[model samples]
Target: MRWQKQPVHYPYEHVVCYDLETITDQEMQDGSFPPWPRHRPVAGSFLTAEWSPVGYRFKLDTLLCREGREAEFYRKVDSLLPPGGMGVSLNGRNFDNAVLRLQAQRNGLFDLRNIARQAESSRFDVAHLDLLDVFGARPGTSLAELCRALSIPVKTSVTGGDVADLWRSGNVAAVKAYVQEDVIATYILHLHAAAWREGHERQLVLPLADLAIWLEGEPGLRHLLSFATCRPARWARSRAPALRAAAALAEAELRLKREQDEAAFSAR
Candidate 1:
């Protein structure tokens, strides 16, 4: 059976939903329980597919391995992704990307310096759209808080902290389930955001009853919100300006501190 083709040009309409699970050695070294001390320096990472629109599909060309699979993972991801396709993630730029790049270097997998140079030269084709950045940068919002505020159902599965324990305990199945749920939640949120963007609507403030009714009979449809939830006016009224002003102040402070440190070092 042929599926309807999604518009390639409309990025907001076509989203690739994904989630990553990472176990940091630093967290382990902090005297955390269970997997911490035993699994020291063994950071297990997993990437899973949550959902993809009709046109796009999840491509897991690389498999995580004990001997460090950074090179393999990078190659597979590069091969699977389309040129210029946006890399969607919960907070990919800040967390996932940083960790992946660091791991890649530690494992001697790839030359990120070259990648940065290529990006500077406009030789890089892929763009990234981070949901965490969007939601966090959104006035007065956190992930769980945003979902609650938006009336999107939150998936209460195992948290990231639980992942390391699960892996160390040899419970691979549980870990997969947890990772899958995370991916699904991320995908659902991404879709809701995308729909809002395409429709030029803002703020999600639908009644729970109405949303459930709208989601009925649709598989994996529980993630989407109803029209009643879109209330841009409420959020815009207060949060927008506060976020902007705060960001401006933060930027100014950073700049001033950097200049002061530079001048002090020069004088010395």
Candidate 2:
């Protein structure tokens, strides 16, 4: 029988995992310090909220980066993510975020640069968690390897090198699927890595009581899996009573356990 994998230590309850598929690098013959983004088309992208209540469920979606609409595509993504919370990916710091910033120079995203700043920092930086950078910077460490190592399925049929060919062949849909799979795999890889580092205690640690707060919508990580319990829109706020009652129940349960322990001790 196969051994079960443990859950990772996810300190941040909120995160956004994303992956970008783009055309070949826009080469600048002159190797300048600030390499501006060239006219390369952003193939497409996918992102998930990484937050689910009492289960592994999440909501992930994709967006196509059509011709002449690079800025619009990038803007929607940038705005989709809120100010804080870590962004997880494989080599996102050096590659994905770099491409995003270069392309987003003309867009009006408020915190677009924050991804660059946080993602490029040390591993301890929670703002952005680039698995490649955190994992000893081993040269040529691809996503497929990490996924396989962690027992997560590498869902895509093609690799990054094949994106341009797929696009050329009118398989833009395939490219989107590929990129979306990468996003999902990245998130799974993170859970494994976190489990490796912090060890898993329980699955779907996010409490149902926090459902209202979670639905209230903080940007980034986990946007997959379907569950009717999570259907309520973010606009429908939860009253303090719901949150407090849950807390009160928990506190009472803990108190009862404590009392039982004390009574047994006294009898001894």
Candidate 3:
């Protein structure tokens, strides 16, 4: 596909927005509860993003693994992204990119020589426009807080602390659903901010169907899926065991809850 060098008209000219979910060691060991940092465990997830003009597209991506998937992820991401496009994130520079880079290095996916060259040559000169940074100048602004301020609905069903438990307890469907909601919320915030910057109040509201349609046209989804498809079965298998464990736990918990409810009803 031919890359479009010129900027598109309207709010898209300024930035692209993306969100990620990852499995950390803390989550896995702690049964999906908030992970402790000392463990330095691996994590993975399905990621999604919205490019300006292209709308909100979801991609199954990952972060932190024993396997060498980070290189593949970066390759896919780089392909979809324009060389100089501005990357807009909630607080991506400090958290998202840093975690990705660390995972890449830990997994031995990054070549130090190539990284040096990329840095020296400035070939990867994409500017990061962080929404958190923009909003940080104003006190009491956060991802959820910012969404509220801008009249955007929050889309996530659970907090990051709960993801490990959700996954460990075998709620894959729920985890996927929750992550997808986050992607939608992130996309809406991006559009809302972009519209605000462009002085268009009416464009601030994005319907879910319109967002899905917009995502359908994004060039990034194909790249991410293709990368995932190319990985070895071993990498995928590693996640399977933990996910199974999570499912088992979830089932037991559900059973216990059901019994408790039944007993309470009988007592009454």
Candidate 4:
């Protein structure tokens, strides 16, 4: 795992793309959809990508707390989403962030609550970026649907609606797999959004290629290796490293601005 080192100043140090799976009943006694607070989180998954010397490298992690370990599950997810890194997700601000905050408050996990709060903001330095919001936050579009429109590779073995039934039938592996697939899709979306924001189109292919290549070695995620084949030609792959530097540099600029503001306030 080596590349000819390039002078790449990545803007952000790292990015964590995450998704949550909860077990809400099919319907209440009154036959209504489950309320928001009742969506008990059973599985959490995140893909963390950090800037390396050559480009960004990723690690995929997941947790299942289906029986009764919701607190532990949230804690593990929180540990990866430390402040000062980008937290990217799809439809997270409305659903996932609220669920995580409410559950963390109930479990006395104040740090997790605060992280969830900060992650819901529109600020650049905040840990959260909702792809739905990024892509106009329009009505009727979903992560899978949007990925299809953008031609990003998306796996659809299961849907969030199937999670509860799978868990109930003792198919916990299926639930975990579904959550992981969503997180990976979210990660792929974030890469495109970042590249587009930074105006570095070629930058998109490398991190994705890197992710697909990394998935090859991950026993639990080998099913997603199809993403590896979606990479562009050799020429595009060769130029991608040079293009990724812009997003990294943009983050550096933001950091510098924050420091300058703090220094001015201290001088007064």
Best by TM-score: 4
How high is each candidate's TM-score? 0.52, 0.64, 0.52, 0.77
List per-candidate RMSD values in Å: 18.4, 10.9, 22.2, 10.5
Q: How far does residue 85 in candidate 4 sit from its true spot (Å)?
A: 0.4
Tell me how candidate 2 scores on lDDT.
0.59
Q: Give the TM-score of candidate 4.
A: 0.77
lDDT of every predicted structure (CA atoms): 0.46, 0.59, 0.48, 0.73
Q: Candidate 2: lDDT of 102?
A: 64
Which residue segments of model 3 deviate by more than 4 Å?
A: 1-15, 26-71, 78-81, 111-126, 137-141, 202-268
Better of 1 and 3 by lDDT: 3
Which tens-of-lDDT digit does each residue in 106-190 have in candidate 3?
Answer: 6576654322222232212345555665544442245677666644445435765566677667776665555545544565566
Best by lDDT: 4
Put down candidate 1 lDDT per residue, 37-56, tens digits, no spaces: 22222232222222232212
lDDT of 4: 0.73
Q: In candidate 4, how many Å is residue 29 off? A: 7.4
Tens digits of lDDT, candidate 4, 1-268? 7788554333445778888888775568986657778887888888888877776678878888745676787788778774766777787777787888888888888877446654466534356777787788674478888778766666568876678788889898888878887888778777777777778665576777667667777786777765555543233356656656766788899999999999999999
Residue 38, candidate 1: how far off, in angstroms? 16
For candidate 1, the per-residue lDDT at 160 reads 64
